[model samples]
Target: MLAIRLDEPKQFRQIAIPEPERPGPGEALVRTHRMGVCGSDISGYLGHMPFFRYPRIPGHELGVEVLDVGPGVANVKAGDRCSIEPYMNCGTCYPCRKGNSNCCATLEVIGVMVDGGLRERFIVRADKLHPSEKLSFEQLALVETLAIGCHATDRGAPTDGDHALIIGAGPIGLATLEFTRLTGATITVMDMDQGRLDFCRETYGIERTVQFKGDGSELARLEEITGGDLYAVVTDATGNVKSMSNALNYVAPTGSLVYVGITTQEISLPHPLLHRREVSVKGSRNALPADFPRIIDLIERGVIDTDPWITHRTPIDKMIASFDSFTRRETGVIKAMIDVSGVS
Candidate 1:
């Protein structure tokens, strides 16, 4: 089986590896039909992710077809089309015991912690696979990405008529924009990339976009749009340390600021500013089980647009040369999907 193996930071090799083991009880063997590359995958490849292990096949947002179901697997069966939940948690942890599997004490995310779906086939726990009959492989592959934003929206609790400011117009940011629309909150999306900002406008009907420049004038632009007070809910999906650290200033007084992007570096906050404003800061991790079903409904109902988000497509065999460019945001790429069914 051919797989994308990360031999080291900034290095990946596409090689023919042995097939994964057959599913055990409570698991299923799935053939990878399509896979979406995530920012976490890019971070792991660039040495920004501490949990990534070298020589691992890295992919988590997967669309797959069940080849066979393990014994006692009742959630899905052979020939079922599904998308996987990437977060594998330690069931006994305090958070997990309390139904918050997103922050489990010992969480092993599929793509980072183990060999994920950047291969011909893989095995996953049966319960983690969400059966979606309405979605194509390409659309279903994006469920994990949408789930990330869903988790953040749930945590941030954006209210009706509140102004929401989402920093970064990348895939996660776009997903946040998509879900926030459901709350009837007026959304103001900000990003340094004009292409992505345009993406928000043309695709999602988002009118307010702050395309930041290195100069400080973008802050003034944001303030003007907000009528001098920024958003009630500010989400930083840029995954940039500077952006996350500076997000508090953009958030309205007593507003909630959620860091949906993961970063390895320490982010500093001005104590006086945070204290004076009584701002709330929160970090959101992987998605919950509820998020997957909600996204399925959103996609099925045409609330979320998957067609435009996917900008590039390549077969699994062409990944070595294309992977780096996709991760670097080269080629105007938004989301790149691999067609594993063509893998020889």
Candidate 2:
């Protein structure tokens, strides 16, 4: 079997690996079709990802087809196309016991902690697969990423007529924008790049946008948008410490602030400001089991669009040559898809 591995930072080599054995009692052998490169993968390539290991197969956003299944596999069978939930959670942990499996104590995110599906074939637990007859392989591959945004919005619990402000217009931010729009909230987005903000307004129908500058004027612009009340919910998808810290200034009094992006550095907050506002602060991690299927259903029902989100593609043979280009800021790579099945 052919596999792409990150042997070290800034290096990727295609090598022959032993084909996976037949699925075990509760697993399935899946053929990889579409695999999306995520920000974490870029971080891993640059040695910026925390707790990430080298010599890893770097793919978790997957759309796959079942090749065969071991005994007791019932939700899907051969020829069924499905989305892979790559976050493997241990069911016996404290969070898992409370039905919060997404944050299980010993969570393993494939491509980050273990071998992932960036190969000709990969084996996965059958329970983590969610099949959708209506979604294409590309759309199916996108389910996991979209689910992240869905879970973030759900954490804030926005209602119809609520006003929400999302910072960052990258893929994750766009996903957050979509689900937030579905909540009937008048959506406004902020980003440093004019291109991204324009895409949000033109492609996603976002009602308002503010180009972020470190200057205090961006806050005033947001305040103007909300008639001085600011936003009822503020979600930061910037994955940047400075921006996350700045995002605190935009939260409305008595509103919620959900940090969807992760950063390893210690973050400081304005004490008296958040204290006086009575802000509800929360962190959103990986998505739950229910989120994947719900997102698939929404895409299937035409409630969300994935086709336009994919702006770049590469055959597996060319991935190494082209991967770095996608990371360049000027390249404007929105979503880069690797055609695993097309590898020679």
Candidate 3:
């Protein structure tokens, strides 16, 4: 078996390792088919991802074909093509007990905090699999990414006919934008990248976008765009601390601000602004179990367009060499999928 490992930052090595053991009770052995390269993966590769342990096998956004299942695995079976829920939670924890396993007290996120599905064969708890017959492996890989926004939108709780301001138009931000759009909220997207903002407008029909310059006119532009009052919902997926801190200016009074993106830096907010508006602030972690299924149905039903999201694909062998350029944005990469199916 071959596994890709990031032995340390700025290094990725492929080594031949023994195949994984047969599944234990309630486990399934899956052949990883498609893996998505995410923004955090880029930061992780560059040694910037917070709490990323070295020598990690980083791949959380996965699409796998079940090779076999162990005893007691009822929902998934051999030949099932599934999108995996990669956040492993300790079921006894308070959060897990309350159906908030996305932030389980002892949560283990595949790729970020532990070895994930970056190999030919991987074992996972069978209950985490969400089988889908109507989508491709590439689209299946996108489910986890889309769910980031799904869970965030759930946290933001935007209502119909309301307005939203999304900071950052990157993959995480775009995923946030997609689910938020489904709630019937009109959206305004901000980004330093013109291409990404243009993509939001052209692809999702998001008409309002403001180019962000560190010069500090973004708040003013957003106020003008929203007709004096700021948006009823503000979602920040930039993972940039400054942007996250500054986003407080855009939320309407009594509106919600959801932080889907995270950083190691401590974020400082003005107390007066928070007090005067009585705005609610919350952090959104990974998706709950239902998020994968919800986004899967939306994609299958043609409500959310998956075609325009993927911008690159390559076999696993070539991924390491091209990864630098991928991070550098040399090829205008929106989402890059690695094909690991042919490996033995």
Against the true structure, what is each candidate's TM-score? Answer: 0.97, 0.98, 0.98
lDDT of 3 at 187: 90
Ranking, TM-score, top scorer first = 2, 3, 1
lDDT of 3 by residue, 1-344 (tens): 88889988889999887888999999999999999998878889988888678898989999999999999999989999999999989999898899899879888888888888889998899999999988988889999999999989889998898989889888889998888888898899999888888898889888899999988788789888889889899999988999998889898999999998878899989989999999999998889998988899999999888899888888998878978777865478899889988775
Q: Identify the leading candidate in terms of lDDT.
A: 2
- Give lDDT tens digits, candidate 1, residues 1-344: 77878888888887787777889999899999998988888888788886787778888999999999888999898988898999999899899999999999989888898889888887889999998888999888999999999888877889899989999988888888778888999999988888888888988889998887868887898889889988899999988999999888888899999999978789999999899889999998889998887788889888777899899898877877787888765478889888888966
Give the residue spans of candidate 3 off by over 4 A.
none
Candidate order (lDDT): 2, 3, 1
The Cα RMSD in angstroms, rounded to one decimal, for candidate 2 relative to the true structure is 1.0
lDDT of 2 at 215: 79
For TM-score, candidate 1 versus 2, the one ahead is 2
Model 1 vs. true fold: TM: 0.97
Model 2, 2-118: lDDT tens per residue?
A: 999999989999989998999999999999999998878887888878857888999999999999999999999999999999989999999999999999999999988999988
